[model samples]
Structures are given as structure tokens and as C-alpha cells.
Target: MRHTVTMSPDSLWGLPQIRAVCLMAFAGISSFAVMLAALPVWGVGHAVPAHLAGTITTVMLAATVLTQVVSPALMRRFSLRGLLVWGLVLLGLPAPLYLWATALPGLYAVSAVRGVGFGLLTVTAALAIQVAAPPGRQGEAIGLFGLAGAIPTMIGAAIGAGLTLSGNFGWVCVIAATPLLGLAAARGVTADGTAPGGAGESLPMRIALRRLVVPVVLLFAATAAGGAVITVVPLELTGSARAALVLLVFGAVTAYARWRIGRFTDRRGHRLVPQTLTVIGAAGMAVAGWGFAAASVPLLLAGAIGTGIAYGALQSVTLDLAFSRVPAGQAPIASATWNAFFDAGTATGAAVFAAVAAGSAGGAGSMLVGTGLFLLVGLATVRSALAPWLERRRGPGRMEP
Candidate 1:
């Protein structure tokens, strides 16, 4: 197996394919992220009902999740290169159409199409990472890819929202078309989606999904917390500049932590990683929420740093663990499933957080506090109760519990 062969740490990055995937992933995700923040603002500015403003994002995410769920089946019919190139086209070519699609129906239609492209782009790119990275260095390679993805999302949102609010929707659309530039990168990646050996083909999808459920849930919760913080902070802060600064801090911390955690887990293993990060996330959420409520900049910034680190590390740790639990042949399925849950978690968090902010007097702050507490309780239940229950459920002949 390629993973069994030793390679230099830097060799993974040296591969032309790895660099291509990273650049394509960055450009593709940046396209999605920029518009994700802009569309809602555009809706609100265009006099879409306040209650329905967030539906723009929800609809797009719904399309994305649905596409991801069925991507494995799609992969059977399409090459990864075909998917990547077409996905970029589908995601990018529609940017200018937004100019004409100013109403709710038009916006949703365009978003849904772009969302499908996003779904195609994300799943294919993730699988490409598995295919492109050196066997032994998959963890670090995935981390680097995560860092590529994380940066654009954080900065893209800030830029998109800032630009849209300042009456530069046209510029936002132009920037959102960044995926168009990635077409060249897309062409450089491996076209085949087949796993190295056919061994993983024997593993049932049900079994692969069952083993992955724990990590998927963990990822979902962490993303929810992170998404809530990212979506709500701007609304709660009095000024755009402060909100942008907080977001920048959060993104920077997350990008760096994800990259480092990949290397750390590659060496030390991942048993304690998720639990520890969850605790950090809980505390970060509480502090940030309190800071928001009290209007303290320092506490808010501090909380963002902690939350970013926890969220970013968890992203790396959980993904590595998920891939570890599955056989190599089943990687595409794993990637699709993980990406689906990741998007679903973010969408759910954004919607739920926005609702709480709209309805509650304490608003986003209280929701953050409650989310933090929820994480703590969830951690306790998983460690004290769920782990043992799962252990007892595993049969003696089955793979290690």
C-alpha cells in the first residue's frame, strides 16, 4: 500500500497534483463562501421579508447537502476531472446571472444551481485529496487542504458582506466568480476516482456509515458552534470594523490550528483529541457569549481565538479519525458523507442561531451560552454513557471497538 511506504514530509506538497487540488479547493470554496454571506445581505437589502432573509442560505445549503448525499452514485458515472471542471463552471458562470435574478425566486433558483455545483466541487475535491496525497502523509495533506479551505471562507465572508453592504454587489459577483480561474487547476488533478485497491469495495456502506456516526456527530456539533459564532457576531457587534476584526482573528486561529493539529495527530494519534477540543470549545463559547453580552472587546476576541483553535483542530482530528475507521476503497463515500454533515451542521447552526437572535431578548449572546452548555453536556454523555454502550454493542469478531 502507498501509505506503508515511507516518504519525506515535504514530498506531499511537492506533488503537482496536491498543489492543484489545494488551489482548486481554495478557489471553489471561496466562490461558495463569498456568496454565502452576500446573498442574505442582498435579500435583506432588496426588501425580502426579515423572516425569510436567512432562507437564501438555507435553500443553498439544502441543495448542497442533498447533492453530497448522492455524490457517490454520481461518481460512478463521472470522472473526478469532469466533476471538478463542470462543477467550477456551474458554480462560477452563474455569478453574473445574479444581476438579473434580484427577486426571491430568481435568487433561490440561481443559488440552488450554484449549490449543486458547490456540492459537486466539495465532494470531488475531498476525494481528490485522498487520491493525490502521499499514502503516509494523508493526515498532513488533508490538513493543508483544510487550511486552504478555511482561509477563503473566513476572509471571503467578511469581504462579501462588507462589499455588499457598501453597495458593491457587482464586485462581489465578480469575486464570487473566482472559481472560473480554478479551471486550469482542476485540469491538473487525477481524473480517476477509484481507490488504490479494491479491498474497501467489500465493506458495506451501512457499516462504513455506522462506524463513522460518532465522528460525524462530533463534527456536526463543533461546526454548529463555530457557525453560530461566525454568523451571529456580526449581527451583535455595533460596528462592521469590529465584527470584521473578530472574524479575521477567528479565521486566522482556525487556519493555523487546523494545519498544526494535522501534524500533531499524525504523530501522537487522535484518541484524546476530540474530547479535549470540545472542552476548549465549550469554554470559548461561554466566554465569547459573555463578552458579547457585556460588550467587552477583549473577552470577545479571546473567545474567538479559543473557539477557532478548537473548531479548526476538531475539523482536522475528526476527519483523520473518520478516514482511519474506513478502508481505502470506501474513501469517496466517506468524503461525501463527511462533507454533507459538515454543510448541514453549518446551515442548521446559522438558521437556529439567527432565529434565537431574532426572538430572544438576550439574542445571539444567550444562544452562544446555551450552545456552550450543550457542548459540555454532550461531551459528558458521550464519554460517560455512549462510549460504553457502543462498546458492549460491538461483537467479539468484529473490527476493534
Candidate 2:
């Protein structure tokens, strides 16, 4: 039935609905990246305690993660569109607060609210793409959507950081809030684009949860490593420029891999793709660990590229598979589940890696542990989702074909 739904031949960027959602997503993410990048720098420059300066991000991310976990359940009684609208309001209205003389507590509160907005914006738009995309073109649509986030990540951080580093904090807030204005335009799109059932009222909680175990676990392992890398890599590198380069490379590669995953999946289907990427990720972890131990820049660069490839591929495959496992009506629940694992794993990974690496030989040991986690989860994913498909590799790759 879903395959029968008509869509433009271009699949990704052709339809009006997709274009609107992508445009809004690009702006929303840009707002987040630019402001998020600037805020801590501004705080640290103003002589705020390092711990306090850092808490801004930690608090916001935690809040965002929490919302991702809870919002889908609330959809039983509320409309997804309504929630998204409120979320946008929360996200956008708080931007100007940065220019004010708010106390630490006040700032923290604002950050929390904005985090909720970001969470809603992210999950809603993701599901919308799946719901509205043309038949046989979901992967391509997601890949195009990935561009919205990727572009901002590549440049927003630099602009935000450069601005705040130069003591132009006021402009950071203004710029950060500007993209959110696009939300108003997005509101004119259809509200009834999705079916209902994200909250588990339509399906038993146990069943819904059990169906998600494979993707959730895989995402958890992958994102855990991702979080650790983001948190520790910069600290391990010798210079700020080197650290920036590593992150930039990681982000660019990740975005490209995400875009490519869709195209690959459209042609190949998911079958062994996630497993393959996980193996590559494990090797990348090995490279990263070795680089950390030897302090080798080239190894680090290679590791970032490899790890990013796996990260993006895994992310796309898991979420896409999650939606495929259930009815279209339940996409929101799947989205929430996928995001919860992603957010929780990231936070947990950073903390655990920091703890273990601090007392061990060096970052290398922690990275090796990351590799171990990926191997474990990758095997689980194969057994759970790909085992039957794996047997069909003797033929053409697609399960249908």
C-alpha cells in the first residue's frame, strides 16, 4: 500500500512537502549549531568557570535526549504537528535571552527549553520525510535531509566559534535564532501527513520495544563510540588547529556517508550493509586507538574518516530499518526509540571512555574497547536482521530481487 503512494520522480528534493521540511530542518539545525558553538566560547571568554561553561551543552543535550525519549508517547493525545509548532516556538523564542544579563540559573533554564525544541524538531522532521516520501525513494529522501544537518555542522560551528572568540557574543544569539523563523513557513504545510500510533497505544509496549532491540542496540554501540570520539579526540590532539581539522574531516565524511547510504540502500537494500559498516567501524577504532597511542596525525585522520563512514551508514540503516519493521502509523515510536538510544549511548560513552581512558595506558585502550563494543553489536545485528538475508547473497542482493 505504501509503495503505491505517488511521488515525484526526483524522490528527494522534488516534492513540495519534502522541500518545505528540508528547508525548515536546515534552518533549525543551523540555529542550533551556530548558537551551540558560540555559547561556551562566550562564557569561557567572560571568565565563567570552565565547568559552568560546559554545563550549557551538557544540560541542553540531556534535555533534548529526555524529550526524545518521552515525546512520542505523548502523541497518543496530541498531534505531532502541534507538538512541533510548540517546539519551534520554544526553540526560537529563547534565542534573544543570550544577549540579556541573565543569571546562570536563568540561562540553564533557557537552554533546557531550547533543547526540548530541538528534540521535537529533529524527530518530527525525520518521520515526516519517511511519511511523505515517494515509494521506493525513502532512502534518497533521508539522504537529502541529511544534507540539511551536515551543511550546518560543517560551517556553523566555525562561524559561531569565530564570532564568539572575537567577543561578538550578541551577534551569535541573533544569528542562532534567525533560521528558526523558517518554522513559520513550514507551518503552512499539511498537518495530517502522518498516521497515528507513535505512543504504543496501538501496539503493546513489550512488543513494540522487543521489535526495536536490534537497531537500538546497534545504534547505542555506534553512538557511544561517536560520543567518546567527539569528547576525547580534541583533548588528545596536540594543537587546536589539528583538533578542528579532525572534527571537520569527521563531520564532512559522516555527512557524505549518510547521503551515500540512502543511494546504496535503494539499490542494494539494507541486508548486510549495516554489518559491513560496523566491521569497518571496528577497524577504524583500531586505527584511532593506534593513532592515540603513537600520537600519529595521519592515523588519526584515517580513523576519523573510517569511523565516520561506519557511523553514518549505521545511523541511516538502523533508523530506516526501524521504520520498515512497523506500520507507517508507528514511525514516531520508532524514531523516538532510535533517538533515545543514540542520545543515551553518546552520553554514556563519553563518561565511560573518560573514566577508563584516564587511568589506562592512554586513549588507545579506550578506543580498542570501543572496537570491541562495535564487534559485539555488529554480530548481534547480523544474527537478528541479516542472518536470513545473508543466506541470499549468492543471488542478487535485494531480498525482493
Maximum-lDDT candidate: 1
- Compared with the true structure, the alpha-carbon lDDT of candidate 1 equals 0.75
* Candidate 1 lDDT trough over 10 residues, lowest sum: 1-10
Instruction: State TM-scores per candidate.
Output: 0.90, 0.82
Clashing pairs in 2: none
Q: Distance (Å) between predicted and true CA of 237, model 1? A: 2.7
List model 1 lDDT by residue over 115-183, tens digit each.
Answer: 899899888888888777765677788899899888897788777777776788898899889999999
lDDT of 2 by residue, 180-281 (tens): 577665664576654366444355667777778887788888878776566556445546566566667776887788777876687667666777888999
Instruction: List residue ranges in candidate 2 displaced over 4 A.
Output: 1-8, 34-56, 76-79, 95-108, 157-175, 198-202, 354-362, 389-401
Q: Candidate 1 has what TM-score? A: 0.90
